[model samples]
Target chain A: MEHTQEEIRKHVKIYISVFAALAALTVITVAVSYLDLPLAGAIALALIIATVKASLVAAFFMHLISEKQIIFWILLLTFAFFLVLLFIPAMTS
Target chain B: MSDMIRYISKPHPVTGVTNAKLGIWCFLASEVMLFGALFSAYILLRTGATEWPVGADLLNVPLATVNTLILIASSVTIVMSWASLAMKDLSRFRIYMGLTILLACAFLVVKGFEYGAKFEHHHFPNSSTFYAIYYTLTGLHGLHIVGGIVVNLYLLFPGSAMWQTEPERFLGRIECAGLYWHFVDLVWIFLFPVLYLL
Candidate 1:
């Protein structure tokens, strides 16, 4: 399970690049928010950008990309329940 | 027996991951539900309201932007700390972890100022649906930050002694903490736009 020196260096490089990407995306999110798009359009754009940023953090930073299948199953279940939670409002309405 | 401890520390034969990692993921699964419920409530409240103030008008975007950078910086440092330990560089690990804690503090201080400004303007949770959701969402997220700081501080200080005796387990613990910290930052990533920008 030990990482070679080269692997460690590679990871550090990836971390730095991910940091830069997250920061750049944040700036883009803020800039786009200022546009006078329709409300739904703005919300969709914002959430989409946020989702991309979240994916980066989860995949690279949290190492979820190479995680075990059990963990993915756990998250899939959580996502299912989360969808159910969101749909309750729509159903009621 | 030592085998039992080893079983917990090493990846399971079937799952190919350590017990600590499995436990943390399970805990995070529950956390997703907790926050998901609150977020669902938020969507319901916002959609149901007749009039809702634009979030940008009420919130301090510049301040939150700074806070977002701070959290992002901390997230990097936390992962770097774990990386340093993995590379057997304790000195660098200490430096990185210390920076992570300091950045976490900076985020809270800036957030406190934001809250203070709201109160000074007589904006409370009951001020409007916007303020109510703002305070609740940010407040809950702030509490998570505090929890992360507490765990990270323990590992950086008193709990660091474990590194000498059980480096692998110590690294695993830090990785778990980093996972939680990254999740906190992820929550804020969404929160920044949802609460501040949108």
Candidate 2:
């Protein structure tokens, strides 16, 4: 699909905003590592921040939010499989 | 009969995406599984261990933090390069794409230094379970980066000629490359915090 010049310019603004958010989140994650939290708490906080950062990149940079229905289906299946793989260790343990 | 390709310049009527777009996503789906399995392995190892080392203690967090920003910046540049094509500015596309490639190279150089330092300190993959997994995961990711650089270099130079003949198809190719590059960056988003910070 072709994007108009104006549309791309609009998207560019969002890209920059995402970049800033990502940069800030990166710093925050590192800073959180220095805190005196328990190991489990630290892991949760860091991963929560990281998941937010990953979502921004996927939604905006990868343009997955507006992507086609079929692609979403593919990703949905992939996510399902991902969940299954994640659960394997838990089940075995 | 002429040997020509279809679905390159335009979206397929059924799928609503060009062939390249669909193909790349499917490829990326497989990639997710590949990395996801490794991530699963990581969880298993960590949870089962009685004594796990702190990543920040053994690793260079500052260097990794810098690498994270570099990858994030490269992701933006890659997308901008695709946008530049949509704006019908080939030169702008080249500039952004070139910046993306250079930033990626800078990341590799920094990683090389990190790896070099590790070797100097005798932190080989066999040093411990930590070093082994660190090298395996990051080393595989590094290979992916090398693969991206090769594709991006082609698109930036010789492959760009297609832009003149088939602009839409060329744009599609850029979009695919951007998707791949962004996936690599996304992997790092997780790898950074999971490996270094936590």
Candidate 3:
């Protein structure tokens, strides 16, 4: 799906906003790390922030939010297989 | 001709994207699995170890933090470059793409110093399980940055001639490169916390 110049101009604004959010999130994550929480808590908080950051990148920069159905299915299948891979190690341990 | 690829410059009517776009997503899917497996290995090994080293204490958090921000900036710049092309501004595209490449190189320079410091203090990959996983993950991520730099450089200079012949197709290439670059940044987002914070 091709965006018009107007839509792209609008996207440039969103891109800048996402960049600011990502930069702030990066700093927040680092500060949270220095709090020296317990390992499990640190892991949980850090992962949550990282997931949000990843989502922003995927949705905006990668255009997954407006992406086509075929790409969605492809990613879903990949995620399913990826979960199975992670589960193997978890189940074994 | 039967040999001609129909969707090089246009989206397939059904699939809704050019072949290059779909192909890159498939490639990224495989990459996700590759990194996912390594992350799983990291989880298992750390869980099994009687004592896993605290990440910040053992690794360099401040430097990793800077690198993380640098990569995030590059991700934004890359998307901006793509946007510039979409709007038919080749010179603006060049500037944004050039910034993306420069930020990528800056990330590597920071990584180099981090690694050099590690080696100076005798923190080789074989130093322990933590160091091993640390090197493996970050090293692979670094290589991805290098790959992004190479692709962005091509798009910035020699490969840019395609814009004259087929601007839309060339823009598609930029979109693909931007996607790949963002994925690399996404990987680092997780890696920083996993290797440096946790």
Candidate 4:
């Protein structure tokens, strides 16, 4: 809360860069969808791009990168739970 | 007693509501799983069907393409709204949030049109095994967009003293809302191709 002006400016610069990267990633997603990649390749590419975009939103736009460590663990555990749900059913089938 | 007191004494930088944002985030994670199950089911069913309707034949790709862009744009505006709040620009924050809500409404309108068109063409989910799952998957995502609009409108009002007295905390709530929104957008991103373009 008591950040100096210089510190604030530095954060702003980084945030802008992240937003720009996300925009570029959006363009890439649309472009890649046009290619004739295998189904698995396409799905993998889409997911990878999505992960990069989400990380930018979470880290810079949402400010999670600067947040407390407890919050990080909460986020990580949540994702872990999500993986369990996604894959657990595959075993039975 | 002392540990609880100490925990209460340490306010989060973004919110004083202790675990409010964290709680919201955790809830949204569960939502991801809920949608994930439906999507995975879609993959399995479509794979097994004898005459799977190729997405292009079953969907109006141009219209869905517009809807996709609208959702992705809303994701950007919602994040910008939170950033404006963090920068202490209340007016700008309100404007951004309003735009996000409008964009969300636009998405719903387009979705309604798409559904209407589908019904006109006798494209009900029951029409085929694929349409059944397609409608169910995208329909769930559509409901989420409507939910997001309601949440944003609730936060947009000037009479909400919580936003006035604790700006950072209010912003954190918006951030939590944004997370839910981005997840919804991501689901559509996956669904668009699976149901329309592909």
Model 1 residue B3 distance off true place after TM-score fit, in angstroms: 6.9
* Tens digits of per-residue lDDT for model 1, B107-179: 9999999999889999999988888888888999999999998999999999999999988889999999999
Instruction: Please give each candidate's TM-score.
Output: 0.97, 0.98, 0.97, 0.81
Computed on C-alphas against the true complex, the DockQ of each candidate is 0.83, 0.88, 0.87, 0.30
Q: Indicate the TM-score of model 1.
A: 0.97
Model 4 Cα displacement at B136 (Å)?
Answer: 1.7
What are the candidates' interface root-mean-square deviations? 0.9, 0.8, 0.9, 3.7
Taken over the whole model, the C-alpha lDDT of each candidate is: 0.90, 0.93, 0.92, 0.72
**All candidates in order of lDDT, best leading:** 2, 3, 1, 4
Answer with 1 or 4, whichever has the higher lDDT: 1
Candidate 4 lDDT by residue in tens digits, A9-54: 5766775676567667766776776786886787688778777777
Docking class of 3: high
Per-residue lDDT of B167 in model 1: 89
lDDT digits (tens) for residues B1-198 of candidate 4 = 535533222355565435665577677667877887786677667555676655766677767777777777777788777667767778887898899999889988888898999899898979888788888988888888888888888888843457767665576677778878877877776677667645
Residues B1-198, candidate 2: write the lDDT tens digits: 212757876888999988789999999999999999999998888888887888889889999999999999999999999999999999999999999999999999999999999999999999988888899899989999999999999999999999999888899999999999999999999998888877
**Regions of candidate 1 where Cα sits further than 4 Å from its true position:** B1-6
What's the interface RMS deviation of candidate 4? 3.7
Of candidate 4 chain B, the 10-residue stretch with the lowest lDDT total is B1-10
How far out, in Å, is residue B148 in model 2?
0.6
Worst 10 residues of 2 chain B by lDDT: B1-10
Clashing pairs in 2: none
